[model samples]
Target: MHSRSRDLVEHAVTKVPAVTLGFWIIKIACTTLGETGGDWVTMSLNLGYLIGSLIFLAAFLVLVSAQIRARKFQSTLYWATIVATTTLGTTLADFCDRSLGVGYPGGVAIVFALLVASLAIWYRVEGTVSVESVVSARVEWFYWVTILFSQTLGTALGDWVAGEDRGGLGLGYETSAAIFGAGLVIIGLLWLWPRVSRTALFWSAFVLTRPLGATLGDFFDKPIAQGGLEFSRFYASGILVAFIAGCLLLIPQRAARRAARD
Candidate 1:
C-alpha cells in the first residue's frame, strides 16, 4: 500500500473501541435498553412493528454515517450507533416474525442465514472477519451489517425460547435470560482453551449477549401473566440508559490500537 493509503487504514482502525470487559458491560446494557425502547415505541405508543422498525432504521443510518465520518472512536457516538442497530433489530425481527407471519423459528432461521452470509462475504472480500482487521470503510460496513443481522436473529431466538405457546420452548423470561447467560459463560470458558479461536469466540459471545439482554428486557417489561415483572417500558428504558451512562463514565474505553503492520 502507498504511504497515504496505509495511513488511512491506520486511521480507520482507530474508529472502533477496543474489546474489553467494559465494552461488554455497556453492550449488554445497551441491548437491554434497545428492547425496552423498541417496545415503548411499538407496543406502548401503538406504532406497531413496521413503523417502529422504520424509525429506528433511520436513526441507525444517521448514526452509522456519523461514526464512519468520525476521525477516531467516540464512545458516545459508537454506543449510540449500537443502540440504534439493536432497537432497529428488535422491531424488524418482530415484524418479520409476527406481521409477516414467519413465526419465531422462521425469523431466526432467516436472520441467522443472513448473518452467516454477511460474514462469509466479508471474509471472502477482506480475507478476515476479526474485529482487529476492521481498518477500512468497507470492512466497517461489513461489521455493522453483520451486527444488525445478529441482533435481529437474537430477538427472534429470545422470543422463541421465552414463549409458552406456538412452538416455543415454554421457558419464561427469567429462565430464558438465565439460559443465554449460561451460554455466554460457556463461551467465555471456551476462550480460555488454547485451541479455541478468539475471533470465533468473540462473535459467539457477541451473538449470545443480545438474546440474553432481550430476555432480560422482557423480564422487566412483560406482564405478570407472561411471567414478567410488568414494569413500564419507558421506565425500564430510562433506567437502562442511566446504567449505560454510568458505566461509560466509570469505565475507561479506548480505541483499539493498530498493529505495527497495517
Candidate 2:
C-alpha cells in the first residue's frame, strides 16, 4: 500500500509536457481557438462583453477548481481547463481593452505587470518557476495565474499589431505571425546556447507563442478586406477545439514528474 501510494504521488508530480515543437503547436492552436471562441460568444451570440466575461469566468473557476483538486493530471480535465482559461482570458482581455477603453497598449502593460507579479510570487514561495516542478498545488496555482495573464496579454498584443488603422504597428496578421515566429526561433536558439538560462528562455517562448497564436487566429477570422480568411469565429474555434481534443486523446497525458522518474 505504501509503495502504491508513492507511485500515485510520483504520477502526480510528473511534468506537464516538455517544451518541444509539439507543445508549441498545441499551445498556439489553443490560443487561436481562444480568440475565435471568445468572439463567438461576445459578438455572434450578442451576449456582450460583460455577460460573456461572466460566463467564461464562471467556467474558468469551475474547471480550475476541478484541475487543482485532481490527485493526478487527467488529460481530458486538464486540457479542458486550459481551453477554459484561454477562452476566459480572451473575453477578459477584450473587456478591459474595449469596454473599459484601456486600449491595446494599456491592456498589454496591465497584463504584463500581472504576469510578472505572479511569477515573482511563485518563485518566492516555490523557490522556482520551472515547469518541471509543477507538483504542489501552490505552484500549480501560480502556473495557472501566469498562464491567464499571458493569454490576456497575447490578446492585447495581437490586436495592437494586426491592425493598420487602429494605431497598431500596421503589420498585417501574416506579417505579425512571421515576426513572432522569428522571435520563437531566436528563443529556441538561445535555449540551445551555452550558459543561457533555460528557465528564462522557456518562459519567454511560452509567452511569445500566445501572441503568435492570437495574431494568426485573428488573421483567419477577420474580414477578407482586413486580410483575414473571413472564417466564422465559431467555426474556427470549434475546429481548433476538436483538434486539441484529438491531440490530448492521442498524446498520452501524464503528470509532471514522470520524466524525472528513473
Per-residue accuracy of model 2 over 1-113 as CA lDDT, tens digit each: 99998777655563265556666777888888888888899998999889998998899888878887887667677767777778888888788778888777777788888
Local distance difference test, candidate 2: 0.79
Roughly what TM-score does model 1 have, to 2 decimal places?
0.94
Candidate achieving the largest lDDT: 1
Off by over 4 Å in 2: 1-12, 258-262
Count backbone overlaps in model 2.
8
lDDT of 1: 0.88
Give the CA lDDT, 0 to 100, for residue 77 in model 1: 95
- Candidate 2, 174: how far from true, in Å? 0.6
lDDT of 1 by residue, 1-262 (tens): 6999977766555677898989999999998998999999999999999999999999998998888888778999999999998999999989988898988888888999999999899988987788877667787899898989988888888989998655678888888988999998998889789788777888888888899899989999998888889999999999999999999899998988664431
TM-score list, all predictions: 0.94, 0.89
